[model samples]
Target: MKDHLSALVQKANLGDREALEQVLLKIKDLVYNLSLKMLLFPEDAKDATQEILIKVVTHLSTFNHKSQFKTWVYRIATNYLLNHKGKRSKEFAMPFKDYTDLIDLGHSNEVRYTKNEGELSLLEEEVKVSCTQGLLLCLNEIDRMVYILTDILGFNGVEGSEILGISSENYRQKLSRSRAKVRSFLNNKCGLVNPENPCRCTKKIDFLIDQKIVNPKDLRFAHFSDRSIDLVGRIDDLEKSVAIYRSTPNFPAPEELLEEIKTTLKIN
Candidate 1:
């Protein structure tokens, strides 16, 4: 696939319209999924994905063949995410205790429940997704990106370093710190990490439902067809164990949006 994409990049740089479109299509999901994880909002992710694709298209000619085309594209996307000014406040930096406190505050109101097992399961999934995403956000930008690329997205150290314009050793060091931090937090606060942990997704379902953070009717993270991270094999190692929660579903770009991007680029 990388070789094919590199060939497409060669054609795209020469202004072959079909090749340009194909190139954009090839990386659309990657840009969107990364933006979604970083931004933690669908609309923001969509807008960012569009903007990143436009940048990629406009700058296609500057791409040298020294690196893989996909790596170049990822460099563009990751740089944009790291430096792009966000309209939304960075409210995700609070400590785990603070996050739970905020949730408890949201649970002040009393609400009735008539949810079935399926509905309850959906809510639990949402909680897990939301909390894990939140944990990612708590890390500093570089650490967060390293964790996302190496642990969550399953990129190797070399690829991750290339994407971020860093050394492989540096990427590994950052990843190690990130893993330790995440594992520590999960071990202390998440029941999935340790049965002895006081926090349980099941226990949070009512609070989330009452706060309308996890609506059965409007399921956010659970609606995607992509496999959940928890289904991955559980390892005894803490870093590997925590990685199970970091994996996210691939979020594909809508066909309509892809077409719109092609149109904007005036690609056939």
Candidate 2:
């Protein structure tokens, strides 16, 4: 697939409209999923994915074969996300201290029951996704990225360092610290990770719905597809706390975004 994408990249750099669109189709989901993980909101992720794809399209010629084309795309996407000052970025910016405090205070402690078991299961999935993604907001952008790439995505230190343009040693150090931080919180607080933990996704659904943090009518992350992080990557190899995140649904980029980009670039 990489070789095929490389062939398309060559054609795209030479201004082949069809090849360019094909290239966009290939990378859109990857960029969108990364943006979604980082931004935590579907709308914000869509906007970020659009910008990242545009960057990939406009900057196609600048991609020398020094790295894999996918790596180049990752570089551009990560650069934009790390520096992005979008609304969610500002809203979620806070220290771990404040974040943990919010988690402790946010729960209603009473589990809400739905008549249908399926409905209850869906709400539980919603809370699971929302809370875990929200936990990422506590880390600084760099740590968050490192944790996502190395821990959740199962990238090795060398590959992670290459993607982030940091030394492997530095990458390892950051991964260790970030992993420990996220893992510690999950171990102590998330019931999915530790059954003994007081916090349960089932118990939080009613409170989340009442507060409008989650809507049963419109779930953002649950039921997207059976395609999960574990299916895409090696989740079992990771620590249990981090492995819980692998159950998250991997969202696809909106198909219309590709057509809009083509229109903007006048590719057709």
Candidate 3:
């Protein structure tokens, strides 16, 4: 597969439009999902995915094959996301203290349970995905990328270090600290992680709907499918905290975005 992808890269660099499209197709989901996790918004992720792919195509000739093609792609995606200062990133740059305060705003505001089983399921899934992304935003960009690459996406230490351009020791230390922070937050506040917590998804459904934060009619992150990171990748031993994220859906890139990217590049 690596050899095949390298051939695609070579063809793409030689201005073969079909090979360029094929290469983009291969890595589109990876770039999009990483952008989604980093930006926490589907629209923003789609835009960032397009930008990253353009960069990938522009730099196609520079790939030295010293590492796997996927790793090189990951390195590019992570570097873009790490330095990304989009509108959403600015709004989401709060520390845990601010995040806790936001959660506490709704902590005692649970409305009455009032939705059918179908709607309840969808809304709960939305809350889970949204809440998980919110929790990740509490971490700094580097630590967040480390946790996502190592824990959620199941990249090992060496791969994570390579993707982030950091030493394996530094990657491991960041992973350890990031995991502890997320675990601690989940233990204290997330009802899914600890039944003792009061922040149930069911309790937030009506409030989210009323506030236009989440719409049952237009579900964003919650798809009615069984696909998750579990089916798509490895998660090491699946520690409890990481398990919370691994169970969430592996979101796909927008259906029309790939064609748009090709058109933008003027690929015939």
Regions of model 1 farther than 4 Å from truth:
100-112, 225-240
**Per-model lDDT:** 0.74, 0.82, 0.80
Best by TM-score: 2
Q: Lowest lDDT 10-mer window, candidate 1?
A: 103-112
- Per-candidate count of clashing residue pairs (backbone under 3 Å): 0, 0, 0
Compute each candidate's TM-score over C-alphas: 0.85, 0.92, 0.90
Instruction: Kindly list the per-residue Cα lDDT of model 2 for residues 1-268, writing each as its tens digit.
Output: 8889999999998978889889998999989988888888888888899999999988899999878999899999999999985686567667878867766765655565475887877787777788888888788889889988877777889988999999999999888888889888988887767778888777778878887778899898877845342232355566667777776757888878888888887878
Task: List per-candidate RMSD values in Å.
Answer: 3.1, 2.6, 3.1
- In model 3, the clashing pairs are none
**TM-score ranking, best first:** 2, 3, 1
For candidate 3, write residues 1-268 as lDDT tens digits. 9999999988888888889889999999999989988888787888889999989988889998888899999989999989886676667668898877666655334445444676566667787777778778889889999989978898999989988988999999999999999999988987766678888776767666776667777777878335332232344466557777877767778989888987887887
Candidate 3: worst 10 consecutive residues by lDDT? 224-233
